[model samples]
Target: MRNEVIFHSEALEKEGNTLVQMGFRCDACGKTSYPVYELCPFCSSGEGSKTPLSNTGTLFSYSVTRVPVGPFKPPIIAGYIDLPEGTRVFGQIRADVKAVKTGMSLKVETGTIWTEKDGTEVIGYYYTPCGKEKGGAE
Candidate 1:
């Protein structure tokens, strides 16, 4: 079965089974926004286009939730990742809580985040620890 992503449909591009996150780059200021805003937040310009974001980023911060919420399992790990394009994105990190660290390099991947009421597998972007940059020195 194919996975379905419900939120921020305009900011997501699907190439077969792979999902790529997109950002809106303001034509006036060269600033980008994740989830694709209609207007530039900095320059207040409406002339911007959607562009693909970097697939890799550095972990800025993270938190572990010990309580289970809805379709999420206990000890859910989520963090803010600083992309190379100067955008900070918040996404769920698919890594061990004990192994998670600030400044670690992470690669974005698409996966099933949860199931819907109609039994659809909700897809979303997630981060996973990647090679090197473990000490945040990248």
Candidate 2:
């Protein structure tokens, strides 16, 4: 399943250089969760409705780490992003450790999370400084 797109496949698409992410709205509680959901984790309701997610969000929290996580090397920046969908997502931050701060504005980017041995591409969500040039690991 390494080649599988973890986020809802139908929810990802490219428009020019920007990537738009979508989420699911809880039919029961109206809570929103990113990348789709079988149930609302907040209300434990077994219902989800697909909805587009805004590319922009604010950095809720973050940390600088020299420890390796997944396909990324040392000095990785990790954080929780507070999306307009009302859900916070944990992801690899695409910025220098010294440049990250709480409440920083960001936007979603579509890029390689890693590549499989079969030469298949594994795409994943990443965030970067909003309105700025591509600002991190390439």
All models, RMSD in angstroms: 2.8, 5.0
Q: Tens digits of per-residue lDDT for model 1 on 1-138?
A: 664655556767876766799999999999888878889888889999999899999999999999998889988999999999899999999987877889988999887788888878877778988866535433
Assess candidate 2 and give its TM-score to the true structure.
0.75
Q: Per-residue lDDT for 134 in model 2? A: 43
Whole-model lDDT, model 2 = 0.76
Candidate 2: segments with Cα more than 4 A from true spot: 1-19, 131-138
Provide the lowest-lDDT 10-residue window in model 2.
1-10
Itemize residue pairs with steric clashes in candidate 2. none
Give all candidates' CA lDDT scores. 0.85, 0.76
Misplaced by over 4 Å in model 1 are 1-5, 134-138
Residue-wise C-alpha lDDT for candidate 2, range 1-138, written one tens digit per residue:
445443435557565765567678898899888667677778889876777787778999988879787667878888899987678877778876777888888887877777767866778788887744345432
